[model samples]
Target chain A: MYAKEKTGGELSVGGPSVRGMTNAIVVERLVKRFGATTALDGVDLTVAEGSVLGLLGPNGAGKTTVVRVLATLLVADGGRVEVAGLDVGRHADQVRAAIGLTGQYAAVDEYLTGFENLEMVGRLYRLGKRESRKRAGELLERFDLIDAANRPAKTYSGGMRRRLDIAASLINRPRVLFLDEPTTGLDPRSRLAMWEFIAELADGGTTILLTTQYLEEADRLADRMVVIDRGRVIARGTSDELKAQVGGQRLEFTVTDAAVLPRMVERLRPLGVDDPVVDEQARRLSLPVSGGAEVLAEALRLLDGDTSRIFDVGLRRPDLDDVFLALTGRAAEEVASDDDTTAEPAMTGGAR
Target chain B: MSSLAATLSDSVVITKRNLIKVKRVPDLIVFATLSPIMFVLLFRYVFGGAIGGLPPGVSYAEFLLPGIFAQTIVLGSTTTGASIAEDLQKGLIDRFRSLPMARSAVLVGRTVADLGLNAISIVVMGLTGLVVGWRINSSVGEAVTGFLVLLLFAYAVSWLMALVGLLVRTPEVVNNASFIVIFPLTFVANTFVPLESFPSVLRTFAEWNPVSAVVQAARDLFGNTSPLAPVPDAWSLQHPVLYTLIWVVLILAVFVPLSVRGYGRAAGR
Candidate 1:
C-alpha cells in the first residue's frame, strides 16, 4: 500500500527511482512438479521495484508456473517465494494483496457488466462502496471502457475484455503486477494498445513481471529479461546484453543471377564471411559477420560495385529469437509442443 | 473491518458474479423453475388416487407433497456440481484462483447462490402444491423449521456435489456422474409411495430410510396424522431428522476438505 508515486507527465520516460529499490518479487530455487512432469526446476528470479522484468520463454517452459507460484496460486515444492517482503507460503494473503496477476486469458466474468466487474473486484479488496465506485469509474475511463461500462462484459470485444481484465487486477493498486502472456491472442493494434497501457502502469511505479513469447515485445518493453528453457533460467540480462551474448549480426543478400554466385563468393571471401551458404534456386546468399553494416558495404564493393541489380541486401542484429534459439538449442516456436497453435501468430504479428 | 467481514465481502462479490451469470443465461433459471413444477404436476395427477389403501381422509396431494419437497431439493442440489464443472472447464475457476479474494469464497459463494435458486424453486413448487389442495397444517415456526431443514440439506448436498465437480476434469462427466449417483438414491426412498406398499425387504429398509423420516416429520408438523394408526415408534419418525442431520454434518466434514484438496491439486495442475 505504500508504493512510491510516479513523478512526471505520462510520456516523460524516466529511470526508476533509486530510493525504493527493494525487490518486489523474490523467487529462489523454486520447483513445482505436476505428477511426473517437472514444470519448474530450480528457477530463480527477482523483480525490482518500479522496473519491468520480462520472463521470456517458449510455451511449456514454466513461465506461467513461475507467475502462479509468485502470485500464491500454486505452491512450489522445493523453494521459497516472496512478494513485497512477505513469504508467499506463510503470508499468502499479504502476498496476494501486494500482487496483481493477469493470466494468459482474460478472466473477467462475461456475465457481469464492466462496471459491475470492476466494482466486484474493488469490493473483494475490501474497498468501501463509494471508494469502490470511484475506483471503478477511474479504471473504466483509464481503459477506455467508460461508454460500455454499463454493458455486460459478454458484449465487449476481445480487446475491450482484455482491458477490463487488466483494469480489474488494478482494483487495489497492487505493488507488483504479473502479466502472463497478456497479449497472446489479441490483434496487432489491440496488442500495441495493451502494451502502451502496461508501459503506463510501469511508469506509474508499479513493478511489472511479464511473461511473453513475443521477442519484439520483450525487446520493446522489458528493462531486463530472463529466458527460460526446459524449466531452467538459461539466460538473463537486458535485451541488448542477451542479444550480444548470441554474437554478431547476420548479413543476407539476393543476387540477380545464379551464374554470378561463384564469382561473388570468391570476391567476398576476404571480407570475413564465415560459413557462406548460397541458395541457387532463390539466388540468395547469407553469411554471419561481426560488423553488419561495414561487412555489407565491403562485400558490395567487392561485387564490382554493382548495387543496382542487387535484389535484396540487409543487415540484422541478433534478436531475442536468435538468443532464445542459441541458448535453448531449438527455436521458441518449435519448443511449444503442447500448443499446436504455432507461435508464428505472436511472432509475425505484434505482441498479439 | 474484521476478518469475517472481509471474508463475507469477498463471498458476496463472487455471489454477485454468479448471479449475473444466471441472469445472462436465463434458460438456467427457467429450467430450474420448470423442472420441479413439472415433477409436482406429473406425480400429483398421474400417480395420485391410484396408490390404493390410502387413509380415510388423506388426499394424494397431502401424501405426495413432503416427498416432492425432498425431491426438489435433491434435484436442485445437483446443479451445484454441474455449474462448478462448467466453470472449471471454461477456466472461470482458474480465473478466481488468480484473484486475491478469500480461498473459501469460491465454493462458498457458489453453494450459497445455488441455495438461493433452490429456495426459489421450492417456494414455486410449494405454491403449486397449494393450488392442488395441499397445505402446510403446521405452525409458522414449524414450517420455518422444516424449510430450514430442507435448505440445510440442500446446502450440504451442494457442497458434496461441488467436491465432485472439483475432482472431475470434464463438465459432461460431472453432469452424468452426479445424476447417476443421485437418481437411485432419491428413487429408492418413499418419495412416490409408502414403504408399506413395497416388497418386504424394501419396506424394512424404507422404514429406516432418512427420506422416509423427512416425509414423516413433514407430515407430523403439517397435521397429516398417519392413517396407519399404528405408526412406527416415535424413534422411527425421529430417525429421519437425525439421519438427515448426520448426513449434513458428515457431508460437510468430508466434502469441505475434499473440495479444498481438489482445489489444491487443480492449482498445481
Candidate 2:
C-alpha cells in the first residue's frame, strides 16, 4: 500500500523495468543483533522503482548493517527483506543479481587495473567475455576513468578509486544499488564531483538506497530521508518536510550586552510559538515564529528605539542541521567525531 | 547459462583476477619460489654431510630433493590462506559476496591460482635440484606422476589454508598461525632427513604424516630410493603413493566444504 502511494511522484521517465516491478527494494520490521548488542531493531523502509531513499544516521547506528542485509551479504536475525521482488533470505542469489553494493570503504582490488576490475565483476555477473569487456569500457568512459583504465587501482587518487568502485558496481546494470558513504573521505571538489555522478545516476532512474552521515549529501541526492539512531527509525520525510517539522523560521538577535537578552526574549515572546531561547553569556535570543517578513517587521517594530542595544538581528529558516539537533539532540559533526575514535577501523586497502 | 556452467565461468573470472595479482606483485611468486630453492641449497651442501643415513647409491642431493619438493609445495599453499585473509580484511570478499556469482568461486579460484604458483615453484626447485646433482631415476611417466601427486597434495593443502584464512581473517595472523602448525608438520616428517634417523614417536609421525608420504612417493618415482637403505616399517610409507593420494582426498573432502562454509559465513568483520 505504501509502495503504491509513493510511486509516480517523480519516477524517472522510461526507466527499464527488469523485473516489471514497482518497489525495487522493501524491508518490513527488520531486526538484527550482534551477540548482546542490537545493531538493527525493527527497521522498515522502501524504495520505489527508480527512486532514491537516503538512510541517515550517526556512526554505528546500523546504517551499514541495513545495507549489508539488503545486499545479501549479511542475514538478518528476523523480519523480511526483498530486493527486486525476491526475498533476500530464500533467494539470496537472485537478490544479489538484482542489487549492487558499494561499501563504506572502496572495495576495488588494488593489484588489478581499473578496466580489469570492472571486467572481472562483469564476468562474474555472467556477462559473456566480449560483453564484459565492452561493458567495462563503457563504464570506464562514463566514470571518466578511461585515461587511467589500464593503470592499477592502487595508483588512483581517493576520488578516482571511489569512482572506479562505483563503476564496478554498475557493470551488471543492477536494478537496485546500495551506496554506503560513497564520498566519506573525499575532498570538497571530489565530493562535488561524486554528487554530480550520483545525480546523473538518479536521473537515469536507478533505484538507490544511500546511507550517509552528511546531511547535505542526503538533502541534495535523496528524494526521501529516513533518519535512524541506535537501531530505530527516529524520523522520515522529504528535506523540506523535515525542516518544516522542526517549525518554520527563527527570529534571532545578538546584543552588545548580556543584560539585554532577557529584554529581547520578552519583547519577542508573544510573536514566537514556543519559549524564546535566551543566552546571557552569548548575549543572544532565538525564537521560533511563523509569518515570513511581516514577523521580522513586527519584531523590529517591537524593539523600535531599542536598536542601540542590538548588534545583529535576522530571520532564519531551519536547515537540516537544526532538524537533526531538534530530533537527535546532538550535532551531526559531534556524533561523527565521537564515532571516529570508537568505531572499528575499516581496513581500506592500498588506496588510503 | 546453467548453474554449473555459470559457476565454472565465475570461478575462471576470479582465478584470472588472482593471477593478475600474482603477476603484479612479483614478491608473492618470488618468495614462493625462492624459499624452496633456499631449502634445496641448505639441505644439499650444508647438512648433507652431517646427516649420513642415505642408502649407498642414493646421493644426499637425490634423497633430499623429494623432501624439499614436499616442503616447498606444502608451504607454498599458505599463500591461499594469506591472500584470502588479505581479501577479507580489505573488503574485497564482501564485494564478491554481494555479487551474484557462485559462493564457492572465491575459494576455487584461489586454490587454482595457488596451484599454478605451486607448479612454477616445483619447476624452479627441479632445476635447482639438477644443479645440485639430484636426478630422476625412473621413466618419464613416473616423474610426471610424481609432479602430479605433489601438485594434487598442494591443491588440497590450499583448501586447508583457505579455511585457516577464513577463520583467522587477517593476512599477518594467517601467515604466523599457519607456520605454527605447518613447520612441525613438515619437519617432524621425513622432509629434511631419513625417517630411520627420527625418534620413535617422530618416526611414527613421519611414516603416517602426509608430508612424508608425499616425499616418499616422489623419491620412489624419481628413482632416488636405494635398495640398501633400511625400508620404512609403516604401511603408509611402504605404499607411499596410495597413502599420499588418500591424504589428498581426505584433506580435500574435509576442507573444501569447511572452507566454502566458512567463506560464506565470513562477513568481513
DockQ of each: 0.48, 0.72
Instruction: For model 2 chain A, give the 10-residue run with minimal summed lDDT.
Output: A343-352
TM-score of chain B of each: 0.91, 0.98
lDDT of 2 by residue, A1-352 (tens): 2232233322321222334546787787899998999989998777778889998887777899999999988899998888888899999988888888899889999999999999999888888889999999999999999999999999999999999999989989988999999988887788889999999999998999999876667889998888888898877778776676678778888899988777777777889988887778878788988878898899989877788988878787665456667888875546663554223233211111
Clashing pairs for model 2 are none
Superposed model 1: Cα runs more than 4 Å off: A1-20, A251-272, A276-321, A340-343, A346-352, B53-56, B90-95, B98-100, B200-209, B229-238, B260-269
For candidate 1, the per-residue lDDT at B245 reads 80
- Top candidate when judged by lDDT against the true structure: 2
Residues forming the 10-long window of minimal summed lDDT in candidate 1 chain A: A5-14
